[model samples]
Target: MNRWPLWAVLTPGEPARLERRVRAALMLEGDEEHGKGPSFEVIPGRGRYHAIVGADSSDVGAEFQIAKDLSREVDEPVYAIDRGNDPWAVTSWRKGVLEVLEVDPESLAESLGCLLPGRELPSDSSSKRPLRKVALVEGIRAQEASRALEDAGDPFPPGHYRFEDTPQGLRVSSETGDVGFADITLSERLPDVMAYGVIASPNLDMFFVNVLRGGECIGHFALPPRDDSFVPAVRDIKGENSPERILAALGIPAEWFRNE
Candidate 1:
């Protein structure tokens, strides 16, 4: 039998009360004028509201899109929950980004119990999976990186480059940097030091200033693009003076950026 996937539209904030309300709303009072709308349930321990719209075997992509649309219309988060797969699954879309992840089925089932009281929970098979250093959920790491950067005092100027916290990682973009051509240089005097142009676009340009540490080429700070048509304010800034500020902004100790 083709396993049918479950769907829900979730609203943010305290979920427990919402779950109770959803349950109450779905219940019929002595078979009279109750149970008016769709039924919802709380995923145990998870902090989000859920409305259970059971099993649709239609196109998964379309289902996901519908969920996204609902999220936008209701101004709240929405999700597609499926237990057909090995690890179980939950998906959501936000800010033109789609996020999907395999989650613990037992935990998900426990949460679904309020709506699916007698249903069987899927078995757990993730014991052998290795732990990941970074979480798969979108924007978590980038937010951390951004906070680190901000606490360090916004070292990089806002004019030429923009640093974004993304699901993949920290994305650095240059507004006026050239993408086609890059300059890479190494210095014997500095030993194991290398600088390479990293990103360039119509509005941005940047370079990776890396220093070797423990046999690894660790990038310290990205240098802003330089052009001859510079204003006096920009011209006065020097490359040599950037490390402390950049490291500070990144919330890393100054000694960490130095060659050991």
Candidate 2:
């Protein structure tokens, strides 16, 4: 038998309470209301989760909604697992928070590292497989690298993205606006560096301004502060984490950061 491509994973305070909310989220009086074998189900997950299963888990469907809704209701962390898709990702929601992650080593390690601060992932592949499996999901990209954001609409839809180079800095543009990778970000990817970081969000709601070297902050202040970065800001105004503020701080031309 085939496995459900996607399901919600939760470690809840009360399973019975959660199930009731799940039923309500599915908008059914009972399981059979959907006219399928059963409209909804929550089973013991393979690991430390109660996997909430339903007919369809796509964002357009009811399956994933239960995961996010219940997390907020119970003040818990709920994850939506999608095994049937590419660049597999774990959709997580807590309170009103959300993040979509792809199932790769470096990035997945970052996600786990945050969850288990100061802990390191063993080098063995077997031990690392679970994190990879659960975090597996499609990556966020804006538009084909070939296209540009021609409109000024809000809530830009996620699609293919393009990375452009300009005199000011690197540009990660989507269908709606250009996400600025300020000069500091440009410095991170300088001609020679052992490794670096890139932080972004699908809708450009998040961005970071930091230049890490030898595992020291030496420069910026970012939110939810990363474990390995001790960077401090120069006592500037708030919102420096934003593209516009970041660009303003650089004293560079703004044409590259703003939507053309």
Candidate 3:
């Protein structure tokens, strides 16, 4: 199992949003053919987020060493691929370097040594699996509902979703969006909200940033704070009044804007 660290490039107030943005960017940038899943973990007193791949609890020390080494070049939250079959890859939210590593004990030693600069890899059998499964209905419902809103519009059409209000819990699934490219699934809520963010799609660009409950942005992207910057997109400033004007101000193409 391998673990990689991601250093977020934003302030503390918006870790959740920033984490989502970084995850979204990875989705947008990664090769769909690879079938890679993005999984993350949060650590306190660590200035950045960690993206562990094929990692087990035993590998935390080694993972931290590798992350320390990566800190020199990776100055932002990045997706690090650590499958034994593929060379590790890291992106700093730019067209920057795309590193490839040969899967060998020496390479692992070198990366850790270089990144941690004389640190040691953790030695424990527990470094077996880092990915976990979530089991919750309301949490799952919220994710599905959010995705549904992203697919069509806010307050998703009645028939569009699957909602079961049983004594057990609430469950929701959308027929249209679930089968399309706008696919998103929810397992359970992440207790570490401090390290997560809300998901938003670029299509929300039309609403001029007005996000209604049950609605979310298309695709996910990290939302880190950096020098008070703004994208100037439709979402920057939007409300009930003159929402259309905000869209117009963004110069959204006619094809991209839809009332529904």
Candidate 4:
């Protein structure tokens, strides 16, 4: 999996300052809040520090969002290392203009490898995969959805969905149109459909399951943190009759939700 590298220049002896800036930029306060920020390491000879963030399995736009947010917070230039080329290119914004610098692959990998033990740099052969297509259907039973998805060679199991990386944003395509992540409206209001099913990303980390009945979204569940023991919660929620019962089964405190 590819990881985007974000780095900034550090003064000769200001490691503590760099740490503080990183914490602030990434909002890494606590485990429940930030989990773990990025993996940080100081370059062996260069005196500069780098933080690697955003997994390839995650949305590519998320990495760019981090870079953009950090760019506004720091005085020093923020570099985004692009690994698609044979020799990776480093991009930065200077004086409101973008600059690209190419570096040798072997040397760069050697330096990064030393800092990131057990991690391997992306290979030159790696290429962007094609956009995945999926069909969304209403009035389908779980068994029928599984059968149809299996016939179409979908990787995800029944009753699960995930957003896909797109140039526009995180999207999930349906027969009607594309639904962007920002456009997802979680409302108690129901639609007129009987049952709804969506084929989406196979990665559970990004997985979510939404159940709609009578044309209304009754349950919307995303994968919880590892410590939350999500599987049992999902099973319990599935057994519940109403949306309130499902929410109660989740064990999380209730909150007021607005209709979108």
Candidate 5:
């Protein structure tokens, strides 16, 4: 199994502010609402929900209990995350797999109260991994994506990127096209982007970019599972510069870029 880096975000009293910050960081575009659910927002985009969970020992049970209790109220299942840092780094999305749950250390500490033996959870805010030039490939299987780009050729196909896959589906992530274990199958609605599926397992899927255009995802339909068909259904050789521009515009976070 691939090791994932755990990340953290501050728990907010108001859900609205939390949501806004998540969208900005993750750059997600969805209409789903958190409402009164026990949800936390990630950075880049604000509309998505990446629930926090437990980090230390004995807290895991309590965190699961919290998720179970909140699941009844929220729209989806709750998750866990290590509460070691203020803005902790977590494997929220790895290509094909989607991280549905995260653990909240602070909440568990407060709930534990005097039960915990050590000093109250430390008050610290820092990043374990710096951001980098992360390319958000809408579709592409991780291994094949990596293989395709092994030597002289680009890692992704024409319009897709390497992604991670989990039992639930695709794990959300931002990494090199080859390293990520993403599902390759995708549904695109862009103008000149050509995306395709590389793997389709019972629980896991992989997809990648076959052709990209204008630096932007061929169209607004790059997210996923869209029903609409692309107009021309072809990739334009001239639009190769678009993906790079997108990365530059996104200002790849430190963590996404790998050293070698």
Candidate 6:
């Protein structure tokens, strides 16, 4: 797994202010409501970008989590530099609602928590496998009804960026559009809306679905289940070689498959 470096910088702005914001986010400096998440600094050419440079930066999430809140509140675009020091993911929350979250594969495969603050990622976060660049999904607005982008985090797909909109759902492609494509959808809508994802690694690959209905999940489950190291079943939630229900739940549609 690609470990996160310490001292992430988030920005496209002045260094002093960015520093103060970073410090405050770590609870090491400021007292603003938007002062807590991870860290990253800006680099030229890659505007709205940040970078990290340490290994044991546990509070590393501070840069993103704290800045996310700020983005929502301030209705500005927040940037998080990948540990790879390439392009930072941009999360723009307009009026407390997500406008867009553009990420990269390196960020997702490295760690979903890298993009989503305070979320538990499997040990597979370190997997060296490549993820599908494009994913087709249903059960939510494609690009907030403008472009097709969602801030959903499930590893890979760069938060569903620059995707083409489909009538049934959204078609989120990768930043480069060269890797491959995967279809991800949510059928039930839990209560109102929910987003599902597929996590893939070289060794273990499975669908990571969070049946969020009014902000809660259904019973988590697993199939062909593992006696040891199994998740809560889907909420416990994990699967092995069996995901028919999951596929259906993911809104993959009955006709998409051949055998059924």
Over 4 Å off, model 1? 1-48, 59-62, 74-76, 105-260
User: Global lDDT of each model?
Assistant: 0.33, 0.36, 0.28, 0.34, 0.30, 0.36
lDDT, residue 204, model 4: 19
**Could you tell me the C-alpha RMSD of candidate 2 in Å?**
18.0
Lowest summed lDDT over 10 consecutive residues: which window, candidate 5?
199-208
Q: Model 4 Cα displacement at 62 (Å)?
A: 5.3
Tens-place lDDT digits, model 3, residues 137-244: 333344544553454333233465544543333433343312111111222122211111111122332121212112122211112211111211222332322434
**In order, how many clashes per candidate?**
10, 11, 25, 5, 98, 35
Error of 3 at 37 (Å): 28
Candidate 1 yields a Cα-based lDDT of 0.33
Question: In angstroms, what RMSD does candidate 4 have relative to the true structure?
Answer: 14.9
- Report the error of model 3 at residue 7, Å: 14
TM-score of each: 0.27, 0.36, 0.20, 0.32, 0.21, 0.36
lDDT of 2 at 204: 28
Candidate 5 residues 113-210, lDDT tens each? 31112323333212222222122333344564355344323223443443454332233243322222122112212223233212111111111132
User: What is residue 129's positional error in candidate 4, in angstroms?
Assistant: 10
Alpha-carbon runs more than 4 Å astray in model 5: 1-18, 23-193, 197-201, 204-212, 218-260
By lDDT, rank the candidates, best first. 2, 6, 4, 1, 5, 3
lDDT of 2 by residue, 1-260 (tens): 02332333444544465567665554444445546443345554334345555433111123344555666765556666533222333556687455444334224323432211122333543222211100000111223222222221212244433444433333444333322211112222232321122232222233334443322224443333332221243333233555456545433334432222
Output the better candidate (2/4) by TM-score. 2
Cα RMSDs, all models: 21.2, 18.0, 18.9, 14.9, 17.6, 11.7
Which regions in candidate 3 have their CA more than 4 angstroms from the true location? Answer: 1-54, 58-77, 80-132, 137-166, 170-260
lDDT of 4 by residue, 35-134 (tens): 6544343343244535443343222222333344456655665555533222333455443233344544334444533242232443422222211222
Candidate 4 Cα errors over 4 Å, as ranges: 1-13, 32-45, 48-77, 82-90, 95-260
**Model 1 lowest lDDT segment of ten:** 127-136
Full-model lDDT, candidate 5: 0.30
